[model samples]
Target: MDVFHVTDKDGNKITNEKVIDYIQQSLGTNACLLPSLRRTVGVKAASKHTAIELTGTDRPGLLSEVFAVLTDLKCNVVGAEVWTHNMRVASVVYVTDDSTGAPVDNPERLSMIKVQLCNVLKGDNDKRVAKTVVSTGVTHTERRLHQMMFADRDYERVHNGLLESRDDKFRPLVTLQNCVEKGYSVINIKSKDRSKLLFDTVCTLTDMQYVVFHGTVDSDGPDAFQEYYIRHMDGCPVNSEAERQRIIHCLEAAIERRVSEGLRLELCSGDRTGFLSDVTRIFRENGLSVTRAEVSTRADKAVGVFYVTDAAGNPVHAKTIEAVRGEIGQTILQVKESYSKSPSEETGGRFSFGNILKSTSERFLYNLGLTKSLP
Candidate 1:
């Protein structure tokens, strides 16, 4: 928790000095730090569906850009803690935004948004200077518990069973397609059959809810895989974590059951990169067996719905739609509801699942550290 502090000409304590310092350093100044010097700042923001907490080195004018990114994501800042010590500064920012939570189940999509925010800090749009990603995937048992939690049922406490089910893990995609309003006919083809055809189909399908007016694609195969995008809205789903998880599980079950039938063209889009590999590893890591899989992808993003039957797939849940949705379904629902309330809002940039991640590159940021230094 760090921030910058300042004073007016009259000598009255103005803003926190560290927050100002961090802002200056982030603007391309030397943010190098000494061992003993540390600055801390804490920011707390809460909306109906999301929360943000940011902490790091202290500098000047940092709040402006931080707020800008939040503004861009339409996040509301609720609280903050700022501090600095010996030229070092740190801040913890709290925010809540359902839009950022739109594709919470898609790893690449979530990673991309975070990476974009980090890039805004690094002062670079170029691919080279991107930020890294730190993630914690969930387990299948965890996902199931999450589903139960957000189920909107009377027995709200059962969601806590996730702790006992700590061993069940899975990597499954869960697409929340409400076909009730928007009647998309593209369900006739496999996601891999026609990339553009399937994408347009999925976008239109979500649009049926009327809550989703904007959509984009992020998969490498514009001609092969499925499309992943975020829908913007005003409010968020319920604030209950239990309800959130339950809804996710339901969505995952629904999407997986729908697509696996082969009759459902909703194939997991994106490329066949390390995503499948990671899913497999998680399955193996948790002692789960991947009985079978219809895996495919077109870019760095990928989709591999495995018929996994064990804990090995648990941690990989984050990589799969099941886990993401299971963990944060209520928030996603809120975003949908918010959009439904205001049908007149302006649309932002549209992206595919892969483009969203590629737009920011948060997933690749960590890999960049292992990469050779640029010339």
Candidate 2:
């Protein structure tokens, strides 16, 4: 509960007092912590589907709750992506009509979905509450990771539950073809649709700074087949064989990771300044990438969920995940254990935030940390 952090004028977390003192004496002041705010949900029409955007203070289970509301509305998520900076988060999800298998077009249904999301985001008792995710003797960090795996009720169904139910001799199938006449590249990916399949694939392309002009996602039961028409930032098709293979490799790897039974990381701790940054840094430093993440706060405990993968953009096996778990857990333990050990430090391990980070590295790191201490 005693989370203190120092911030330079640019909002960077200062590890030593010398930096903080200099900032204060020469540059004035900056932010030290992130305060929670009431949730805000925005919706729009995208292509032929519904695009829903959410923004608010960061909290554990937030992503799960958002998808839960969509499920209740009988909406099928075709694409979704989320980013958390500091404690502020913004996410966009593309959904379609569950029964019709087409983009949502009814205004009434969209409005209802929006209203229900507001209720859940605001923690309104009148609507419904997600069952509290708890465990016997489970630490806060594990709790956050568990939310990504178990998440809210219906999470498995929501994510299409392809991880556990796959062909006995199944393998990811990926191919890329150029449609020069259309001036775009057609990438066909076939894989068991795990949680965030669309998000992960699309996020990878977007992360590469490519533009997706058109795409289609379809799933028969747990297996999903998706095709995307993409081009480089300059609108050039990816014609090089090596480049196409690279894209396929990264996407195929991501899709396969979704089913890697143990690809979940949880963080349960008191919310603190620069929480997201510190946690995600572990992922980056370890060559891990977060495909999906959800965060929320309950009873002063930060509960977060993340689906992660290794350097090749595939989920790590058990051994690698263990190392990732240890590094992150120790980092958080250091924060909490330092509360009493570092009294002279005004802010134990706090950082600052401004605009949504534009760089890939900062984007990778800005989107994540949380522990007992301020940093």
Per-prediction TM-score, please? 0.21, 0.31
lDDT of 2 by residue, 269-328 (tens): 665433455566656666665545545444546555566556444546666566666866
Candidate 2, residue 98: the lDDT equals 67
Per-residue alpha-carbon lDDT of model 1 for 256-321, expressed as tens digits? 211211110112434321233333333344444432223323344333233333332222332443
In terms of TM-score, the best-performing candidate is: 2
Regions of candidate 2 where Cα sits further than 4 Å from its true position: 1-171, 263-296, 302-375
- Evaluate all candidate structures by whole-model CA lDDT and list the values in order: 0.30, 0.50
Alpha carbon lDDT at 159, candidate 2: 26
